[model samples]
Target: MIRLLIADDSALMRKLLEGIFTAEGDFDIRTARNGNEALELVRAFDPQVVTLDVQMPGMDGLTCLSRIMIEAPRPVVMISSLTAEGAEATLEAIELGAVDFIAKPGGAVSLEIDRLRPLLVEKVRAASGARIRRTLRLTERVRHQIRGAGLASRPRPSRVSPSPVAKIGKVGMKPGSATLPGLVLIGTSTGGPAALDIVLPQLPADFPWPILVAQHLPASFTGPFAKRLNRECDLDVVEVNRPMPLKPGTIYIGKGDADVMVAPRAAGVIAMPVPAKGSYLWHPSVERMVASALDHLEASHLVGVMMTGMGNDGAEAMKRLRLTGGRTIAEAESSAIVWGMPGELVKNGGAEAVRPLEDIAETIIEMVNSCAAN
Candidate 1:
């Protein structure tokens, strides 16, 4: 049986979660009324995974999460409301080592909560097996130090500090490589937000190729995520709202509720939103985006990269891209948070190169530079 902990201040919520998990029959459940209680239960129960609410009296989710990481680190899934502030906090939790998050179906107590059973269970299961560490990076430590020191008239480092880049040796094109790639396409899910935070910031401001991203996220979350990326990264990250010519150095994030596709116009390619169809399992489906690229851009001028995610959404499409002379890269297993999507591509022979997360940005830069040279 899977060991699980449900931490929330609301008695109603705690009971509801208990009922849901109990009904599932495979989970061994434990409950906590607040963060303090949750911490105690974490030590005693030693759950494989935990579901932490965003807010609670006496100890909020963020504070509790920090404590847990310091004391007893394990997979944690945040329970958040579907609001802007909630989205921001949820993202922060993910950065703080939470595996995933679930937006409370309706605020405190809604019957709709039951509707999220599948997602909640899935996230919990995934979190239970995640790889995490209790120690913080130097930059991360400095941020907490500043906060605790009350910003005392001292030089403070940025809060969202980048992780150290792993030693990535040389990566090169295969023999008889197809035409040089001009467009860059990236597809990711699961722990992608945190992964993107690492890779995107490493690219230069003058990155030559136009880039597109298809990350699995809700409509309410992507805007804030894009804004966060724009603030932290050198590249200009913008949400795709209408059809406009793709520009170099700009990263277009597909809208969360719709499909983003590239259309060839007389002047250039324009990205437009298409209504979601049941055929696509993920909103802003990666496969849909790649299909559009295949239709409009030359195969040789396209590069597809599949990063950390939970499904094989882009595997077949990446394979097709490779077959058509486009380059493809998959995140190496060791560097992936889940290795689901990238693993799919690598398993299916779609990737020409499998690279570590720290190496992916550099690899892309090299691919673009080499393609330009060719």
Candidate 2:
């Protein structure tokens, strides 16, 4: 049975969550009306997982998450509103040690609660087994990476700070720059954002290839995440909300609720956002993105890097990439928040190299240089 705690300022919400979990029959449940109460119960109730609301009277959710990480580290799933402010705060909670977040539809309560129920339950269940200490190490890793890239700030060791590289100016790519030596395709979910922080900031601004990412996220959250990445990484990052010309040194993040694909255009290859395909299970679908890239570019001119995520979204497409001469890398199990996706690649003989999160950037740089040399 899973021991769980639900913390919110709303009595109705607390009761609502309790009922939802109770129906599952295997959850041992507790509730708190505010952060203060939640803090006390964390020690007393000793839950395997926690559901924390972003808004609470007296102390906010981010403050509570900070204390929880320092005092008794465990997996936490944040419940947030689907507004812009809520997305920003939710990302902060992720850096502060919350394993994942589930956005509350229609503000704190809504008719959409029924639709969100399964997602909320699944995330909480996933959080129950997450590695809290891995998150701490990741926080440290990103800080060290930023400092090496000349963008360091001394934030707390366990905290994911606001854009450590925000002061670094972005470099514009010359249109029609020499054929992209290669394009890097990264796919992740679950612990992806923090994992990205460790890798993207490590690459220099003039790095040869453009990067495309397919991270599973909701529509409301992806825009904020892309903006956050733009500030934190030296590479120019933008959400692919429209057809954008592929540019070297830029990172294209697929817009949430839609898929991003690369295809040939009269001017050049453009990365464009398209409606999610019905066949794929996850949106900003990794499978579709890699398949699309292969349809237009040589497999040898592509590199697939699979990072921390919960399912095998990119495994098959990338397997095709490697079999056809493309280079592939999987995040070593040691550093993955969830090994499901990368593990699938490893099992299926897709990855040419399986590297830890810390080594992936260097591996990418080396592979890109080799691809260019060829």
Candidate 3:
């Protein structure tokens, strides 16, 4: 049985969660009334996965998560509300090493919880299997940020090997031409936000191609998530709410709950959020998004990046991209929290280069520059 802990100040909330997992018959569960109690149980009970509430009585969820990351590193899933404030706090918790989160049931009553039961259970189970080693890497990032420009951070991802210029973007594009720029298709989930933090921040404001991101999130979280990335990165980041003109130096985040796609327009190529495809298991699906891009744009002009996430959402289509003469990069196993998405890409022989998380930005830069020179 999977060892699990549920931590929340509300007795009702705690009980409701316990019941949900107990019904599954695969969990050896424990409960905590508050953060202090939760901390004690973490050391004493030693659960494999933890569920923390955002608004607990004693120590708030964020603070509690901070302590847990330092005291006992384990997979954690935050129980968050649906509001903007809840999204912000949950994002912080993820940065602090939480593997995933679920929006709490709408009402104080248990009846509403049935709707979230399946997803909540899946997230908790997934968290149980996630690698806690990502937490150590994140802690290193946090410490570097705390130094306040004192010493440079740990080595940035090493310089990518020199690749054929033709293998970069479109094979024969000359510099300074009027031809519209190519697109970068990026798809990730689960630990995507933190993984994006490491890659996107490394790119400069003048990045040569537009990047489209499909990050798995609920509808309420994507807007704020895009805004947060905008503040931290040099390139402008915006949610793909409408059919927006594709421009270099801008990163388009696919709206949550829908699939973001690329299609030809009267003016030019545009990035737009389309209704989620019924066939894809994950919304904002990486597979569906990459397929959409392939249908409208030249395969050689596209660069597909598969990063930290669960399942094999992007592996098949990215493999197709590589076979069709496009480039692809998979995040290395050492840096992935789950090693599912990118691992599949590497296993399938799609990834032209497998890079550690820190080196992805430099790799992209090199690929884009090499393409430009050709």
Q: What local lDDT does model 3 show for residue 101?
A: 87
Worst 10 residues of 2 by lDDT: 164-173
Candidate 2 regions exceeding 4 Å error are: 107-110, 134-179
Tens-digit lDDT track of model 3 for 222-253: 99999988877878999999899888889999
Higher lDDT: candidate 1 or 3?
3
Alpha carbon lDDT of each predicted model: 0.79, 0.82, 0.82
Q: Could you tell me every candidate's TM-score relative to the true structure?
A: 0.88, 0.88, 0.88
Residue ranges of candidate 1 with Cα displaced over 4 Å: 107-110, 133-140, 152-181
- lDDT of model 1 at position 135: 30
